[model samples]
Target: MASALSEATSFVPDEATVDRFYEISGGNPLLLRALLEDCAAAQDRETDVLDPCVGGLPGSALTHAVTTCLNRSGQLAVTVAEGLAVLGEAPDSALLARLCGLARFSAMQGLRVLRAAGVVTDLGFRHPVVRTVVLENMVPERRRELHRVAARLCYLEGAESSQIAPHLAAAARVDDPWGVGVLRDAAEEALVEDRDLLAIDYLELAHAFCVDPRQRADIRIRSAVVRQRNDPFAAQRAADELLGMLRAGQLTPAQSLATADVFSGCRRIDGVNEALAALRGPGDGAPDGPAGRAAAVIEYCPPWPGFAPGTRNPALEWEGRSAQRGEEGGTAAEELLRRTVLTDSTLATVGNAVRCLVYTGRPAAARHWVDVFVREAERRGADGWYAMFAGIRAELALMTGDLPAAERYAREGLERLPKQKLGTLAGGLVATQVLALTRMGEYEAGARLFEQPVPEDLFTSEHGLTYLCARGCYNLVTNRLSSALNDFLAIGRRVRDWGIDQPQWIPWRGEAAEALLRLGETTEAEQLLSEQLSLLPAGHERVRGVTLRLFSQTVEVRRRPALLVRAVALLQSAGDRLQLAQALGELAESYCWLGEDGRAWAALSRARGLAEECGAEHLREALLLHQGPIRSEGARADGSYEDQLARAVAQEVVSNQWDGGWRATLSNSEKRVAALAAGGHTNRDISSQLHITVSTVEQHLTRIYRKLRIRGRDQLPVDLQFCDGPTTSTPCRTLP
Candidate 1:
């Protein structure tokens, strides 16, 4: 059939080709192709049409070429053109129609022709740039003229916003009041449809045409949020702009509160502090109806209505009280910080503030606020707000070490959010699940959550931060030091970008810094930590604790006891038992070196107890693996890896000299197996210990043979090398 079509067309080349197709049949593919088929028949050759500009018709012969050779050739020429047109140009149906017209063809017919030519596809306008152009191309007058018609058609056809944006925007541009109103309504419907990158697109468009300042602020805030996940720098820039608006008093107190939300997403401490400054700025001092009420929801009304926390800043508390009563506090403190909390806008800032506080480690305060906000949201039957607050509650639970509760709340939040509207919230919900699973020792499941394609416009300093945490944790547990360092560096970049000054991230920063220290980048690590400590207040316990740990480790390795003592003191005050244990173990080792057995035993005992209490198996294992500090009942001994090797040579034991055998005695694996043997680690633990198959461990032991070795893992001594020790070159046997 294709050959018959090919035999009915003619070829044309050069300058006349561009004009030929159009001149033949008004550039109509069906009509021009008909003419070309006639031309091909006259030449008595298979219809073969060649025209540089196909317009509506390339020719009957070319059709056969496409249908037979070109289509099967895997050539990208036609596919590329279609991608450029459909993905590159047509965002909306109206724009599609206009593009068809510009190409001098009917919209439907043009699509059919492209489809026949295998040049265009129907991706349904998920591509943003395509949609942008399509909507923008419809002249304002025409768009307004057609918006209502297009909307009705779309509604009847069950079409989506992706199918309706260009029409609505066109209607909005044409000043068709009904079209504009319907477009606004459609925008809201579209916005609520998903929690994805696409959701941002629709919301942003709606915000652009929205005259309602409050709604626009809401959309802008959402846009900032989506942007923060994809490009933190851009997110910061947008957040700063919103802060600027708030600071300039251009936005209402309510708007300022919403704008502050955009800043909350800012990972940088600088951005957070900047937003905090704006949120607490001078304009916040005065009363302004519902807006004032909204502002007070976050600031003044501590945990509940008309009640404030005792820990609240006295001046701020006093100001909050005065504002709630509609009476000025009559002081500069009051004037600098004041806003009322009323029923109208109570849900917006109140819940978000609680979330922020929890994340920053003000758990007690966050709990105080969350209790009030959750109750209020439920009482009002605001399901959306309920879901939002519920999610925040779940996050707060995670922060407080209530893993089960966090999982339950996260599940409940996911279920509550409308199924159809799961876009970015879905991503957020999934991320939460990853955190839970990772903490529960399910690394693979957790890694799956990060598999989503990162959109170009989606900004996330937080995602990067969280990713660094997860990746680093995995590497740390698995002993993949190099991979762990990469994750740490990634986290450092995010931290540097986010400018997070709070102590919440200090532990991760410390871990990364420690990893750098291990990688022999001590100078760089010290400088980094020094810079970190400079920003933190001395009163901050976590920062001080981490600083001390790093200090103790770095200095003590150089045998500096004074620095170690200072580090131990700092860690002790922070209740960091695990770190304290490790630090004390190091001190005990030093004591052994100095032949102070009694002091070493006391420190070692204290370290063991602390490690057990903190569930620090790794640290405990470290202490037990080194024989030097062992003060068993009345026995005290000091030995090093070097001393062990020396003893092995003296014994002439064949098992002693093998590198693997040496490792079996003092290696971390052997230490683990020993600890687990004392605790009854099955064959599984033994396998886990050597990071090898249980069969392999058994084989090594069997090779020791009956006369030379002990039986079973239980009979293995702490210092027994499985293979033979090294033999020296003897002077007595040195005859020529």
Candidate 2:
């Protein structure tokens, strides 16, 4: 590398710079030599050194190098290289000879010459970019002809259709029965491997060349189904293109039914409804065969649920309707649902089923179906399906009060689906994560949720009700009372306007009542709590316990103990350790208000135990705040500020034995902490590594900062050294 750099540039590079060039240039000799040549020709070379950052090189440099090398290999080798680039498969000499119209021995000779030129190997091009460069340098007409010939050669060689597909797809919509078959098989292979774009491209290519109307419609339907598993925005574009074809009478009756199912899968309610209606025609509301089964599928998928006046939690309402429809949805819809479940369930079909099980008060059944769905999704390796269903699993965990598990699953789902591709699934999954964090008293982590950017349409979706409610709870706990109240109030407005009032989605009234009560709006608090109680269905002791706990606060003091007693019984039975801990704390507060000292301590003690078990530091902290205002360490009527400062200084001066100024003044623990902070360990990392709480780490840092005269961790002296510390059990001497 150094020799190459010395030969190409006026300046010579050192050993370290040569090693860096080799490493970043990615082990490709052609690419590396090209980089050195490009760096030599750069206009900035007057000021720059011989060492080149590969990213700074001209992209055309590699292409030009490969082109010059091919020319030096002579005409036969150049033709062989072009054919190989067009094929992009294994370097089969026979196939190369056939595609390039050369004799087999001549092709072998050319390949040998090319390999010796370092443009290729006995296997293929040294790098994928080299292959791409060969194609890039070729004219469009020549490239197209090579693709056509390559497709024919591969087919005649008895290759699999999938192996022959790229050439046909690249041949610019050639009309061949065999090529269409190859593209179709290629599309299926791509879909299996989750190469959605390639699959869609292959299907579209086949569709363009297909002459039969039925086959063309079949391709369009397949494209729509695959699109449902992709970006919702891209799916919209595909749907729009299909809609034009539908209106043009390009689709048969059965084709329309299939298209309607695809639309339903996309959560496109209006599009599904319209397409099915067109299939039914004027008086055929209940047509048999394809049309009836299609309409039944639509009916089975709960559309935007309509709420009767005074209906508060319509998701439960829809859940009941969903059950009734499954039983009486006639033979067609029942067969589709059963068929989908038993054989091959699509996301839309299984998602609706899981939705029913999750929100309809069946935790065990919900867990079972979620596990089954997740296993199926994983087995198929469909990231989008796994993400969506895994999010549902997280929601189920949240509902069951498994706070840690809920956050874990939600995080996994988010990791699988990038935020840009999340679509409507974002709100519910994000809401689940925030709510679990809030419930576990992870307020700082919960607060970080709001800092992330979301889709502009996120707040307008149906799941926005749940997302806003989760944010409102975080706001409520963090003392943003007015913002919390506004969040809940907006949910209420959405309930009336959009008619989606699912308590499982968001108990907005209950959340608003807490915010209002905190803000001292008593009347509205009482009314909202009352409405929340009425809205909840029977048998959800968990949701009921939550509402009753809040309601206990709204009543008179004498009546409070009785309401709280009922809440404790209900929450204890419900087995939500987090909520039960919170209820116990609230009951303890009520006891204190009533001057029942013995009972107050008992309840507070139990609450604290539960809070610690659940890792709910905020709840434990709340107990502390209830006693009185927390004071600073030196705060008292004992002395003035200066007098206390002098006393503290005198104690520090007498305590220290070393002569290193402020460094000597630190306690052994404080010294260990300062050294770790100087080593760039974050507060959480320091706390974990040192076997201490984050709060204690913070306190140590505060005292260390005051003693060392440092403004922040970054300002600490880099020379400050300490062991991972003899007392610490951590094996590492420094933070990883």
Candidate 3:
């Protein structure tokens, strides 16, 4: 049959080409013959007609052949074929007949002819290409009306919502309530299956066709909420409609809840209170339901609402109600965290969870939950949710002293949600970024972000408290003491006014005290540190560690080492290497002031190592300033590099023996310099058959300071050997 068609078109087809005939035509010999002849006559020889990906039955010859074959087979078969194309696969015979405007028995006879031609099996196309050809050949208006007919027939026959959605999606709206209801139900089901994009498509279709104004508004609200799962900003297209419906109280209980979710996801704090009102208006139930969940979130809303909560922060009462509010809300937030993760975890749920953990200073727990939120948000493409969670992860890293991780997560989060779209909630991200940069000694980078305008309401949000603290810390480090003090005081006042007492997480008082100490206001610094200490619980080692270290600065020199020792232990137990390094540095100073040379060197050595491990270049430089302090009282504090080397030589001459190890980090030539600078003998040989070369001590000392200064003074492991001059042929003033 293929050969005959090929001959007619003046082309010879091989056996392999005949195989393509079976594949595309589904073994229908008549269809195959026509397709083969069409292929031979085609102008584009490079186009493979057999492969649907390259080309298939969408042109004039294939359409005419299909029409001719169906017409000769009988018009009844053509009717059934068209109906099957509209109704999709395996539709009921009665449904197909009704969609085609034909009787059932007549449609069945047409279906039989289609089966005999191998054009259909089980009342659907024998091949996808066959269906594609028929569907493409269909007239546009006819195809649309048939889809409407198919949808109506499915509805009349009591088909499932899932079964009806596809037809409704393809058909034009006829103002049918049943169609709207099916689309809505199918959209809900699609959400449960995690097909968020599909859910949005269905809701959009339902909204377009819904006749009732309120129904259409409600559909729009649902759509905006669903859209948040992919991109929160995308949902803002209908912001006016959604917010207007919300303000007018036209939404039902369920729609109101969805509206609340949309508002929260978009960072519209102004709308949160109104949504909360609608949620609690008449249908609110137990505190664990949707209303309660939202209430728990609103309870800690930054710029925390007045006494009753969710009132949008107009609180001037300034009562000492912080302790009470913190206890109640902390319990509520912790209780509700696990119940609302992932699918049930809205923006409110995730925010409340992280805030609660931070309130208690449980960084490990906070990191675990934020990680959970991040993975699920990324997988679902929920940009706003992922951004917030990622920022929270960065904040946790900051608290726990993983400075590098803190910087990485914060930069990534800011990238995920650009600062322009970040709104007031961007406070957390900016805070994390600035603080991480401040600690890493990148002041210029941190300053650039400060010039970028953030939302004015940041100072009023809970996130603003953190941002203020970060800014103040930057000020303190950079020597702007007054500005640093003011920022810290602002945080202190807001945290108290807003009724959130989280000494462990909010270290404003400790930070302010440090700034005061630097300004020589010793009395004020000690008072603030004491107040923080009196209020802080013993269980919070992280904040206590930081507070203890800062407080040590104001104490007498004799008492400072004890306080610093405790700070070091506290920070070490809390697993905050960054804070631990700071505490160790302070302790080393205390040991120096007490004239304990050995103890001071040990503390300085450990502190330098910790600073290096934390990648704190600022801390390491600070450690270098302490080398003179840890020396003996008679040792030259203002020693030049050469003078310091002279002292080391004097120690070697008086002792006549030395056994401190040089680390393996030194090169062979550098080791020779160290031994030569030591002892100053006329001649000497240590373990490696190397004689001392004591020329130019200053030159050798310079390299030594740069490399091993951070590891403490003149100390090496048991790796390098040292020998001394002897009066009895020990090479002192006598060459060996």
What C-alpha lDDT do the candidate models reach, one value each?
0.47, 0.66, 0.65
Cα lDDT tens digits, model 2, 116-210, are: 77666664776566687678778998999888888888888888877788888788866567887788889898876778779889988988998
Q: List the candidates' TM-scores in order.
A: 0.40, 0.59, 0.65
> How far is each candidate from the true structure, as Cα RMSD in Å?
22.9, 22.3, 18.1
Better of 1 and 3 by TM-score: 3
How far in Å is the alpha carbon of 52 misplaced in model 3? 6.9
TM-score result, candidate 3? 0.65
* Candidate 2, residue 39: how far the Cα is off, in Å: 26
C-alpha positional error of residue 593 in candidate 1 after TM-score superposition, expressed in Å: 6.0
Order of the predicted models by lDDT, top scorer first: 2, 3, 1
List candidate 2 segments past 4 Å from native. Answer: 1-140, 152-160, 172-185, 193-197, 204-318, 321-345, 362-381, 402-405, 419-422, 440-448, 496-499, 502-506, 519-529, 594-599, 624-736
Q: In model 1, what lDDT does residue 145 have?
A: 55
- Give lDDT tens digits, candidate 3, residues 150-220: 88888888888887887887775654768888999999888788787888888888888787877898788
User: Where is the poorest 10-residue window by lDDT in model 1?
Assistant: 727-736
Instruction: Residues 1-736, candidate 1: write the lDDT tens digits.
Output: 2232344433224455545444333343544464454455644555345532332233344344334422332323323223223324444545545423333244555455444433334523222322233334445554455554554455546666555655555444423333334444555554344333454555556666777666666666656655532233444556666766666666765565556445443322233334434434343433345434433433532212111121222223433343333223223223222242413233334443454354333556556566665675566443445555666776666554445566566666666555543333444555565555554455676566567543322234343454456567666666677787777666555444444323333345566667777778776565555444443432334345456557445543434343344445545544446566766677667666667565566667777777665544555677776545455545334334324323432342344311123444444444344434423356676677557788865554454333235445544421122112211111211111
- The alpha-carbon lDDT assigned to residue 230 of candidate 3 equals 53
